[model samples]
Target chain A: MAEAENKQVIFKQYIEGVPKETDMEIKVSKTELKAPKGSGAILVKNLYLSCDPYMRGRMRDFRGSYIPPFVPGQVIEGFGVSEVVHSDNPNFKPRELITGLTGWEEYSLIQKTEQLRKIQQDGIPLSYHVGLLGMPGFTAYAGLYEVCSPCKDEYVFISAASGAVGQLVGQLAKLHGCYVVGSAGSNQKVDLLKNMLGFDEAFNYKEELDLDAVLKRYFPQGIDIYFDNVGGDMLDAALLNMRIHGRIAVCGMVSQQNLSDAKGIHNLFNLITRRVKMQGFLQSDHLDLYPRFLEDVTGYYKQGKIVYVEDMNEGLESAPAAFIGLFSGKNVGKQVIRVARE
Target chain B: MAEAENKQVIFKQYIEGVPKETDMEIKVSKTELKAPKGSGAILVKNLYLSCDPYMRGRMRDFRGSYIPPFVPGQVIEGFGVSEVVHSDNPNFKPRELITGLTGWEEYSLIQKTEQLRKIQQDGIPLSYHVGLLGMPGFTAYAGLYEVCSPCKDEYVFISAASGAVGQLVGQLAKLHGCYVVGSAGSNQKVDLLKNMLGFDEAFNYKEELDLDAVLKRYFPQGIDIYFDNVGGDMLDAALLNMRIHGRIAVCGMVSQQNLSDAKGIHNLFNLITRRVKMQGFLQSDHLDLYPRFLEDVTGYYKQGKIVYVEDMNEGLESAPAAFIGLFSGKNVGKQVIRVARE
Candidate 1:
């Protein structure tokens, strides 16, 4: 292959607080497709990129994080849809549509072919691999069914209701014969939750001054399951409203990320009194159930039982702003960047 | 029968912050134990009283507490060892030694005989039913084995090291071939943790200016299991020092009990990053394991594999002060009051 090249988004510095646009920069670099002749690797041309809130955690220079910090001036890596341009590895063939951990920019050279899963179904939007049919959807399914363990007629509450994971969690709870209520930061998101997402009730947490009172008004019988995304005062309030033997699936804590001073939770004593079970989990930990997750969620989508919405940015340059939007609750549904179209 | 007299301890008012002697008053009242001739009931002479930290939560008028608040001018009830003096119930016989929820007084008329368990072991000290061989022991055992699930060579950390639950957890971890470190408020307690309790290391948290630094210095390999008795800064520090896939068994948050302003934990994001599992549980939730708990702990004590320490106060009058000392970290090991010990 004559003089191949790759376009990539690079981390410039460790984020201090709320990520700024300047923290990331897009640049193009030249690379070899042959992987130095002897090495076994596959070169991929990136198609779709996933903009997830968890990536913000990797931007910080903290020890003991789930994943390591993105190296400065290097391609920022996350789950992406790509087409294999060339392969030295026997498993991967040229022109194969694949999904795996890839760069934020145009192309990537993935050495490990095992990590790249071949896209089984074609003609559907390949970007769905990054959203509904991928990590976020699996997160919602696993956290709800496996962690929360909601029973029929149980009250389910999801915070950050219109976000990627929360949106799917609410819909799944509704499908599970649960009474679902969600809290969002915007009126549009609240409308989407109640009207589009099939939540029984939705409220704009920004408009509601007292979260505890709002929860009481909506869920008089108390919350049976809480899919916690935005942890802070909301978590504290939900603790008070949890029923006996309530289950809280702690997926994320986006609300406390950028704050210089974290919110203090006073109602934690209720965990013991009410016999509440709160568990924190990562989708990666439960990877053994991935095949089942794909079948269940894809089946739900095909049957028109589930709908996934995404806020798509146009290019790689917009990826930084799209990610920063996660902290301020700017995006609706799953945020994605259409790096390239098939 | 002549009119019977009942001696009881009653709350004078809702306690503010740490409880004072003035907050509670002991009084004697007379009542006939007549249950309309057909009612099943039993009158008991209280033997040993259990002074627990969770009772401090009930002292306040908190709405969502595990146990109900002590009513003004009424008996303060808790788990106690008692002997039935009069029985109108078929299950309970007069002179039977029993353990159940009872009043903090000389005598009580218990209507719920089914909730009470008759003590079968005759040779063991009856007071041991309130501490070492009772709820506290079971709490430490279940919380550690079930929640923490420490590996054979894992590093375990326990806060409030010399307290009731913490003391037992340290010994249990040691028995499991895990390296255990503990924190206490005083040097005396710290020494006891290292010397008597078989902790690998112990520290006085009060003397340490930086909790995070203290944890880092001790747990160089990182903590695999953290038995959290004290929350706030210590909990935050433990979060930072936890190894990947660490388990935090949150048994109590005694540090933040009296403070009007509790510290906000900043390192909770570590839960997602490190894939840590932090869970809070009550001893009663694991009641099914009580029989197994009794057998295991009894064997450990009899075989000289486990030793329990108690700081006992003489008479019922000192019970309130003994409980108050718990919040201030004044009492060592299991704080109990010997109210007419057999």
Candidate 2:
């Protein structure tokens, strides 16, 4: 078989502060559509790429982290939807669609077949595999349902509400009869949260000077479940506003990730005073729930009980800007890149 | 009957900074050796008063805390061992020894018999009822076994190791066949922890400037269970050295209590990265466990498996100084005042 040009996004080096677009570069390489002999691996043609906030952590030189730091001069990997171009694995074949952690390139030779989940296309968009039905979606699902364990009519406050995970959390809690309130960076995101995502209340956190006052204003009855994504002053405020036996599900701390030194959290005293249960969790820990999560989230999407908003940047070269845009809240929804059109 | 003079410790006013001897005053008041008709109350001659670190939080003007702040000019209330001088209630009678929430005075007119527990003197020192057999002991017990749910062979680290709760936690973890390390405020306390309390290793946290480095040295292997008593830099350091699925029971934060603005905790990122569960708890939440805890601890005490150290200050007039000594780590062990020696 003749070689084809493989366009790849490569990490130049580890980052110290807020990552810039210059930190990543697009490199063109040659690839033959083949898997190694005696290797039970498949070659995949990348379709959709996911740009997530967690990727920033992998860019750091930190040794002890949940995910290992991305090696310099290597193609960064993330949750991507792909099609089998060639296969040596018995379980997969050419043109079979799957979703898993794949390289930031036009093509990849996947070695771990166990990591790939054969795509179940029930008239759903393939891009959704890296989003509402993917890691971010499952994170929202398990963190809220399992970790927070929301009760009906309880007050639910979510930070970073317009992000991939936060948007879904608000919708899920709202559907469960919770009085859902969300905080976003922009007025548009806040509007989308309240008007489109069906959140009972939404606010632009940037506009609010005092987070504690804002929380007290919206949640006069006190917050019962806090889906913490921003995790700084919002967490402090949430701690103060939590009712007795309230739960704080620590999903992500996007607010603190960019700074060289994380901001100190001061209102932890409320954790004891309110008997609040603050649990930090990863969706990977709840893998046993994925099959059910996929099924439930799929049903919600089809019945229009849940709606996903995705911001798409076209082509492989747009990858760097799309990824960097996440930190600044530049993207409106689940930030996705259309790597190629089948 | 002739009324006796009552030497009572009264709260002068709410304190913003660390409480001092002057914050409380010894006032002489008249007390009759009688109970009012149909009052359904009991009059107790206070014997021993327990000085706990949690009282510092009560000194603040902050409302909505676990326990309400002490009213100005009222006798400060705490766990105390006493002899019932007179009773109008059927449950308690004159000369009945008991331990309950009582005022820091030579004599107390207790209105609620429901709050009192009739002391079961099993040759155990009456002082133990306010320390190992009282709120602090139960706080350590319920927080570790119930909240942490620690397994055998795990690595446990307890802060404020020589304090009333920490000393017991270290011993309990040792009995459970776990490797335990403890941190104290002074060299003398550290020696007591290793030599007398049977801790595997103990360090004076004040001597070490880098808390994270000190924790890393003691726990070369990551910490599995951290009973956090001093919750400023120590809690921050514990977060950095926590193993996956580790548990941190937030028992107290005496380090942060005195400061008007609590020191910011910065290493909470480790919570998500390590999948650590940090729970803040109260002893009152586990009142049902009191009977079981008392039996188990008493057994451990008798078998010489557990030993408690008491730091007793003679006379009711010394109550203010003894209580003030706790914040400075001046007391050797469970600080108690001998209101009227048995």
Candidate 3:
């Protein structure tokens, strides 16, 4: 077994309020770089690390959430693309590319590989296994189609529009023949949404103080489907402007995730007035659609019907700032850390 | 044609804040108690008029709601049981009993008779048609069975548990083998929920200062289905105590209807963590189930498996006060105004 220095990002302690870059620290540790014999584990070198908003939920000392909180003084765990170095599991082979839950380190010994999927190497970017083809992409697919149940020419609104999930949701709604409008934090992201992503309309949410008036201006007839990523004032505004029998797919609450307590939504009465259906879903629950999602999304990407954007940061040391930047809306697209090149 | 003095309750003006008895006035005017020849209209004598919480929405001058608001200086309209005095329409004959939308007057000339249904005298009390077998009862059926999707042994919670819709919702959940708990504004209503309504447990929300703690005390395992009738603080409390994959049926917002601006719900992030589905539905949308509802509920009542409770007022003179009392939680059960008897 060859011993090597494994560079890692470690969780400092349970977080409160907004996460700071100091909450995580970079460290170097010795690793065997080998899987134990008959241990059914695979040792892999991490390639690309994903920074997702849902990861923030893991930083708090709350056991009641879908995923458990990160332990203090441990390697931070997240979705990552990796290349296998050694394997005791018969199913996985050496040099095979895979993606699933992995530690934020240069190398990791994964004992639980049930959720892992082997990369097909179909000319798509390998880093996309953690972005466009990963949880965020799948979240967009499930939330829009299954939860929102979009119809052709129906008015659609999305928050966090240029980010990982919202960007994909907007593109998919456009491809579905929906009149898609998106709101993003920065003017650059807003420009990207309107021009680059082919959204019907885009606006900088940071510039709008009254979201209700802005939503009404964009959708005079009222929004038929709202893909809510940043839940706060925007969610309340969207509720007031929903058309009859509207559907709201509550994907994430990026804006409220930083606060110790979430902001209150005053317009839920609109749910009854509009006869709306507001549902919260996780991509993991809709794993049955993964195969179909991969096939459809891959075909669309190849035919240039859909596009993906990534805000890639260099090295493991940048992982903390990149993850923390999510709360402040700093990243434009799928935020990923490049740990190693293929 | 015969002439009669029509005693009516006229809505004085569009209301703001909680409704008051002064918002309506008793008016006596002459009316021709006969339908015009060649006109497809029916003349009816109003019998039992139902006072519903949703009627408050009609008081506000808002056109975006599912139903249009009430026109001031006109007769207040509501669901009522009536007897046909004269008819020009072939479908309806004189001396026939019916249940549908009618004015709060001694005699009403209903021009649009499309929604009217002839009531069958099956040894059941005629007032029950406006209480247990009317819109409120149907709301309970559709909201509980269709929206909540209650499973056997699941925990169920109902707000305003002794009210028209909530009483029926609690009973139906109990029949479905769920462990039911209900919250009311008074100890008497709580006693009615536990003993008379057959709920497994009941609590007085007015007595409990901390709604979250009270909910935890009642529903230790967390609620699987919450029939939210009075949305505000209790709804926020229910959101925090929901189990994984819980369903919340947004039936009405009696608490919010009083306020010009609705109260904000702060714990909506739990919807994502618990994977909860919160849906708003109207009973009219589920009318296809009405036939089945009539059959099932009628059988339950006949077999002594279900019971209905009513808070009946003496006459149309008490209609204004009875309707206004709903906002203050003064009525214990289904609030109905008995205008005349068979």
Per-residue lDDT for B38-128 in model 1, tens only?
6688878888899998887777776656667777777787889988877888887778999888889877778877778888864667788
Q: Assess the local accuracy of residue A171 in candidate 2 as a C-alpha lDDT between 0 and 100.
A: 93
The ten-residue window of minimal lDDT in model 1 chain B covers: B30-39
**How many backbone clashes can be found in candidate 1?**
1
Models ranked on lDDT = 3, 2, 1
Each model's lDDT: 0.84, 0.91, 0.93
**lDDT value, residue A227 of candidate 2:** 94
Q: What share of the true interface contacts does each candidate keep?
A: 0.49, 0.63, 0.77
- After superposition, the stretches of candidate 2 with alpha carbons farther than 4 Å from their true spots are none
Candidate 1 structure quality by residue, lDDT tens digits, A1-342: 755656778899887678887888878888766544556878888888998888887887875566788888788889989898888788878888898798887778887667778996643568889899889988998899888888999999999988989999999889989999999999999999988989999999999889999999999999999999988889989988999889888888888777645766767656666777777789888889999988888888888898888998888878889888888989998998888777
How does each model score on TM-score?
0.94, 0.99, 0.99
lDDT of 3 at B48: 91
Model 2 per-residue lDDT tens digits across residues A1-342: 558899999999998888999999999999988887779999999999999999999999987888899999999989899999999989998999999999999999899889899997779999999999999999999999988999899999999998999999999998899999999999999989978899899999999999999999999999999999988889988888999888888888988888756879997877777778888899999999999999899999999999998999999899999998888889999999999995
Query: How far out, in Å, is residue B319 in model 3?
Result: 0.6
* DockQ per candidate: 0.53, 0.75, 0.81
Docking quality category of candidate 1 according to DockQ thresholds: medium
